[model samples]
Target chain A: MAQLTFRESIARGIAQEMRRDESVVFLGEDVGAAGGVFKGTVGLLEEFGGIRVRDTPISEQAILGAAMGAAMTGLRPIAEIMFSDFFAVCWDIVANEIAKSRYMTNGQMSFPLVIRSGNGGGLRFGAQHSQSVENWAMMIPGLKVVVPSNAVDVIGLMAASIRDNDPVVFLEAKSLYSSKMDVPDGDIVDTLGSAKVLRQGSDATLVALGAMVPRALDAAEELATNGINCTVVDVRSLVPLDTATILREVSATGRLFTVEENPRLCGWGAEVTSIVADEVFYDLDGPIVRITTPHIPLPAADALEDLAIPSVERIVTTIHKSMNS
Target chain B: MASTKVAPAQSDVAQKIAMYKSQFALRQFETRAYDLFLENYVKGTSHLSIGQEAIAAGVAAAMRPTDWTFATYRGHAHTLARGVPMTPVFAELMGRTNGLMAGKGGSMHLTSVEHGVMGSYAIIGAHLPIACGAAWSAQYRGTDQVAVAFFGDGSVNIGAFHEALNFAAVWKLPVIFFCENNLWMEYTRTSDVTAVVNPAADRASAYGLESIIIDGNDADEVYEVTSRAIARARAGDGPSMIEAKTYRHGGHSRADPGKYRPAEEIAEWMAKDPIPRYRLRLLESGVSESELLEIEAQVNAEVDDATEAAKAGGVPGEDLLMKDVWADGGAAWRN
Candidate 1:
């Protein structure tokens, strides 16, 4: 096993897939020689050569359109949209073309492509760059949404996204790029629709995705000392949701708390809360609570940004208050 | 700008006859589609390629079977030209069980990969970059196949059009961006909306490509020009932009009466209808009138057979609604 940062794991995971498949090619702005805008793709250009790894212009529509066309033909292309917010510029292509192509074509075309972007806040990049946009992708019917919280999950999920025969929107938490984890050497793959239970508890279930997973875990540890034991469930795949794991954990805990970085309105938490409220209503001992950012733009200031996104302190306080009440 | 492409060979009588048949098939198909729409047999809306058959027929004749073709929402002619059986095309238009896409994609999204009709995109200018991507795949795989995208004059104003042109030029992709300049963008005149006189060809220089314009009503011209462009692409000379000047005899969609056009202008273009002109050319070139009569009879019979077959098809099954949404052939998002 070797210690790899989340950003390093992005490159490692892509390299693992590209090395395995000759048809796999990667492209985006500054993704080739400049090693990606986030420096997550440092060695891909040199290792794979320009043919396999390419740097495109500042054309989001063209980048995604090319990826879709390439995927429809033969190549399994990975196109990076530098920031998750940039999806708005090319939302028509993503929401209309790539998402619906296979179904609209009645399975005549299989889009084995991945569109990865640095998502969510922590760098104080303000509203445009830092806002979590997983909800935008999740609402689309034909897309498979994935967000990995840590280095190991990032590598595993990236591999799964590349291999899957559907169009996948891989959201990399920008906040966790610097975080490190010990990853096993060689190719590591993970299932697309499985949620991982990091901590086992019975009092409450803390469901989180992307950057919120780590915060949920941290809050669980603090809540354990306060006599409020909690279970942390990492929602790795949002589309092919492992509702089995979520329902099982939520049922066991009898109380559900969703830690979301996105805005509160119609967030992923609301859907999960709705599902729990419908399926296992009698199993609940307490009301379900969602801890999320307010329905407002993320601020650029360090203090304001920290307050906007769900932090460990916020998760602990929200869960504790709900449990006590 | 001068046309930089090498002059193409003179089409033989056999090739001319084939082009005539292709155009005849398209004209009949569109005429029948409009009739179906009026009779309420075709639901929603359909954009017909009535007078613009020459561009589609010519491009399809010039293209190899392995080459890919992308068309706009008004793509019935392009789809039919690729030799996708008329019955399935008509069935899709009528939203039948045996439709090309099993009625999943209606008239606007005809896709028959086996026939090299990649797809018919509804969005303006979206398929240009997609065609570039397909060309990129062909190049990457060393397939020597080319991708052709057909759009209207309006798409030139869209962002994707410029981006795709530049991307294809930069990458040296084997793709052709064909613009069927029907002189109007929806209800508006192309000249009133577009800055350049030739929407597509005028912008070719910006992407370091040659500017070439052809008479879209002339099937022979479209076949020769596109053949040259396709050969250049296969030879790895990169992309080409062709603006085929034509006019739509009907409205943009089934709803419009096309009163926006001037009576004189409509009369002028209607006189140059590609079918009759091609027929006259054949007769003047010493071709027997009986030969032309035979082609007309065949096209009429084919259209009749296709319409009958399409009308006989049943509604799609309920299970198909959730199928094909994912690769596993199920739309289950959660367990």
Candidate 2:
């Protein structure tokens, strides 16, 4: 087993995939010589050379468009959009073309493409750079949205995404990039659309994604001290959601609480809550609760931003409130 | 700006007219298809390709089967010129089980991967990015296959069009953006919307791409410009934009009569009808009139056969409604 930071894990996975498959190539603004803005692609250009690990112009549309085209033409392209917030500049390509090609072509075409973007709001990067927009991608059909919280899961999930035939929106939490964790070194391929039970409990089911997974784990530990045993389930893939696992957990606990960094309204939590209500409403002992960021845009002020996002304390409190009620 | 360069390999008027006759066959097919559609044989809304036959014929003639081509709603001519069987195309428009898309994609959406014609989109400039992506894939694979994206003059103003063009130019992808500048985007004239006067190709310079403006009514001009663009693309010289200046004689759809177009402009454009002009040119260049008549008769017969086949081809079975949504044979999600 090798202990690696989240950034190194991502880089290792990409390098391994590129080595394994000659068709897999990486394209981004500074992914070649500069090794990405966060060094996630460091030393890749030296190893793979410029043809495979290419540094594209600062056009997000081109980066994504080229990746889609490349994927269609028998190349598995893993494109990096520097920041998740920048996806707005090229949403048309992502939403319409990438998502609709398979269904529109009557199964004649497949977009085996993966788009990686750094998300979350902990670096004091302000509103433009810090917004969590994974929900926007989750709403679209024919796209698998994966959010890995740690180094091990990131490496495993990314490899799976590269091999998957469908297009995947891989969202990486910026704050968790430097976080270190022990990961199995050789050929780590994880199953997509499956929730990982980080810490099993029976009192309440705490569902989270991306950065919120760690916070939910922390909250579950804290809740254990207070006699409230909370089960933490990391929703790795948001689209083809692991509803069976969620339903089993929720049914066992009889209490549910979802944590997400995005705004409360129309966030991923709402979708989970709706699923639980629609599928297993009668099993719930209490109403489902969602601990999410406020409906306002992410603030530039560090304190305001911190307060805007859901924290461990919020998750713990929401769990307690649901248990008591 | 004219330079005395070496002549093309085939500039004979007879060859040009033969190409024009092929285009006329496509035009005749579209016209007869529309007539059948009005007579209640074909279901769904039909978008005519009355005046833009030359653009499709000229461009398709210059492309190889390995090269990719995509088009907008006015895609019948493009599909026909790309060698998709006429019966299947007409059956598709009529929503029959024998259709190309298995009767799923009606008039607006047509696809034939065997001919390398990537499906046509109903959206204006949506296919530009897809074409760019496909072209990029070909370049990445180290192949000489080029992608051609055909759209209307209105698509130039769209964001996807600009974005795709800019990306293609910067990446030097093997792609050609062929804009059929038919002067109307669903009742809005290109002149009324855009301030640019001469050719829509002028916008290509802004993206640092080579641009060519050709008389779309002239099949030979279209063939010449598109051939050069295709050669440049295959040679890895990067993407080019060609604005084929043409006009749509019919309405935007079956519902509108194209009331927005002026009678004088329509008359002037009709005077340059691509089929007759090329025939006259062919006759003047020593091709016999009998040959032209024979070609016309053959085209009419083919169109007639296609119409009869399409009419005889029964409507798609109700069970087919659930087919081809996904490749893995999954049921279509009703929700």
Best by TM-score: 1
Question: Model 1, range B47-162, lDDT digits (tens) per residue?
Answer: 99999988888899999899999999999999999999999999999999889998999999999999989999999999999999999999999999999999999999999999
lDDT per residue for candidate 2 within B145-213, as digits (tens), equals 999999988887877777788888877889999888888878887777886763357787788875577
Poorest lDDT segment (10 consecutive residues) of candidate 1 chain B? B1-10
Q: Quantify all predictions' global Cα lDDT against the true fold.
A: 0.93, 0.83
Fnat across every predicted model, in order = 0.82, 0.38
Off by over 4 Å in 1: B1-9
The candidate maximizing lDDT is 1
Q: TM-scores for chain B, in order?
A: 0.98, 0.94
Score candidate 1 by lDDT. Answer: 0.93
As a TM-score, model 2 comes out at 0.93
